[model samples]
Target: MTRLLFAALLAAIPLTAPAAPSDPYPSTYAPVPSPPVLIRNATVLTGSGERLDNADVLMQDGKIAAVGAGLTAPANAQVIDGTGRWVTPGIIDVHSHLGVYPSPGVNAHNDGNEMTSPTTPEVWAEHSITPQDPGFGTALAGGVTTMQLLPGSANLIGGRGVTVRNVYANTYQGMKFPGAPWGVKMACGENPKRVYGGKGSAPSTRMGNVAGYRADFIAAQDYMRAWDKYNAGDKKGDPPSRDLAKETLMGVLKGEILVHIHCYRADEMAIMLDLAKEFGFRISAFHHGVEAYKIADRLAAEGVCGALWADWWGFKMESLDGIQENIALVDRPEKGCAIVHSDSSEGIQRLNQEAAKVMGNARRVNIDIPPERAIRWLTQNPARALGIGDRTGTLAPGKMADVVLWNGTPFSVYAKAEKVFMDGALMYDRGDKSRQPVSDFMLGQEAAP
Candidate 1:
């Protein structure tokens, strides 16, 4: 009778979802079908600091079958003469606002920041993604295969950032990367202070920012303890009420979600690092860290990556000390993870050129950043920072065949991506008008040619 009564009580209480949802807004991405192909006699930058001249790349069954010299093509493969071209893994932009703050920028499209509160971790950047934002096609034309779409830096704990494939889809879910982890966006330095300060808020100063983080994390800790107790069967009462913001924070505490913070000053980054230590969460990368060079060695030792612009600076006080050699300096440490990222849509179209600018600056300092090594800023390092390093960054056997055929050395201003492939499928061709993807939003709006 006691067992029967307990079963009835359990049935009367609502069943709560698991701590981590397995498929809430799950990815529905599907790679475009492709066939075997071979590109012979090209200069290949493997994206792992290895360059091979007169090499051949094989693509079959939606993966990089092989990369070598004097390799024979399969009988059914379409052969291409890569005589004067260069091949590199497709570019991956670690910082981007492509869909959230999409093109034809207007008041209606301004959905990036949920500024009603300072700590709104419940919000998600993917919810604002408009797949028909013409930016995707333009980015693809520039050889970008994957990108992390993030929220604007307006709040202390802004929201969740999503990693997505630069592919055309009717819905953002179809563009989401299947197994990519979510990133929580946090900001430090000027933006948050200035924003809330003018509004007569608590976090009008840097200390206030630190306090805000601590308070929220403390609440999250309590929330986690409640759930943990229930899961461990230590609590006989009903399971604790779920808080979306706390759930997101608990994901960070559990190392399920990556932390990407927007910080400019070195001291503030150090403070953030200390805060992470207090909360027991890991930071994946620091975005737009102009002062990252000041603590390059420490960041390398901690295994944190710096996703920064090549030369952008001086527009704001925090960015005033930024130098052109920032990327190179941050990359000086033995284990330094440096990535060149485009936070602007216009810059996203010329990420290779941005890396070239860094290369030029590094050369002036006698840093000697070669093409092979510099390519890591665009490919491997960004992939590692975004938690997709094992799958898509380098051209390796069994990896995604995201390759770009450049008309010349990619570092040169004259170079262009002649052909762009994602998962062995030809997604863009510079010479083929039909192959160019036009967004549905741009269909009838294109000016007459």
Candidate 2:
């Protein structure tokens, strides 16, 4: 649906206030605004299933001006020589934990999990985000232009995740991606059960998990109705006393916020889908969906994305059925929304390589996956999942000039992102000491961040 119609629909639902509330923490994402530039004579992967050998990509005022062969450089546009290099949209990691669980992992840094309860939608990942986390620069150096910082899976509802531009800043808001819809992070399987069950808590089993979600969503539905009556002018008194947690839940039900769940098993994922149907909400993506191959058609039918790792398997009981061919199998159908995600800090650095691995795995299974098509697992697909497809994720005209220059074929093991741009501004240059970013936390510990 168009954003206008969606907004009108959102307005129809009873909200605590406006759907787009003044961000208590607003983004400080001011573009440095690079000059118009012409990147010529490169192998361009446009993220639209088209590869152009010896192409020219033009950028003007931080947006793609044009992309094709023999594109003329506008007046005084800086010309970038891209001979023998590969240019594509900067890689986007849909799942990440760069800030909340920053580098130099320590018990003191364990802020990802809010284990006080199975549901804590009142919390937000941005509040706990430490912008000085060196991991941001590391991922940026690896060509990650955008990512979402999600809450860990310890809770049945682990607060909200923040989508961000991979920029180094002093505050989390400074790094927040502009106009990105927030997502609620929820989980279905072992994590919630184990954590609460270990404490002799309520959700000691999978059944308990389902019951908890139902109870909470039911409460939210009732809450919405109450305010809805008031907003409709039939009710008497002022608005119902605000419930931060319930407010977020209502947002999901009203389609104001996206639902990104961490689910592994196919049975549990199906159950989650049923729960979403029951509550009248949408499940955007199933993070770490190891067994999604079993229900790939169901997910595609529902237009839900499966944000999964390329080959992560067997670390836990829920993940035992995972296969390296999981992504390949899910991507087999033309309708499937197969995504390559990294739940780990280390893995986020090379999401391109991870997608490449999935492409290779698919080819080995006699499935011919072309580079242009496979690159979507790293770019436009993730953007579409994140609800930012119109702005970034491709080299299309008027999209953000978030481009990456690879030293070799991006799918090859020997490849490296020699240059990375965000909004046409040079952010990371492997050959230049001046352009690389270094976070405050790593000022003394590490030299090149």
- In the order shown, what is each candidate's alpha-carbon RMSD? 9.2, 7.0
TM-score of 2: 0.94
- Model 1, 345-392: lDDT tens digits are 999998999999999998997888889999999999999999999999
Q: Rate the local accuracy (lDDT) of all candidates.
A: 0.90, 0.86
- Give the per-residue lDDT of model 2 (tens digit) for 1-449: 22233223334533222224547777756665467889999999998778999999998888999999999998878898999999999898988988889988998888898889999998999888988788888898889999999999999999999899887665777678877999999999999999999999979999999999999999999999988989899667787998999989998999978999999999999999999999999999999989999999899888999999999999999999998888887774567778899988998888888988988887888988888888888888889888999999889999999999999788887889999988887878898866777766655564565
Candidate 2 structure lDDT: 0.86
Q: What is the lDDT, from 0 to 100, of the residue 314 in candidate 2?
A: 94
Which residue runs does candidate 2 get wrong by more than 4 Å? 1-22, 234-236, 446-449
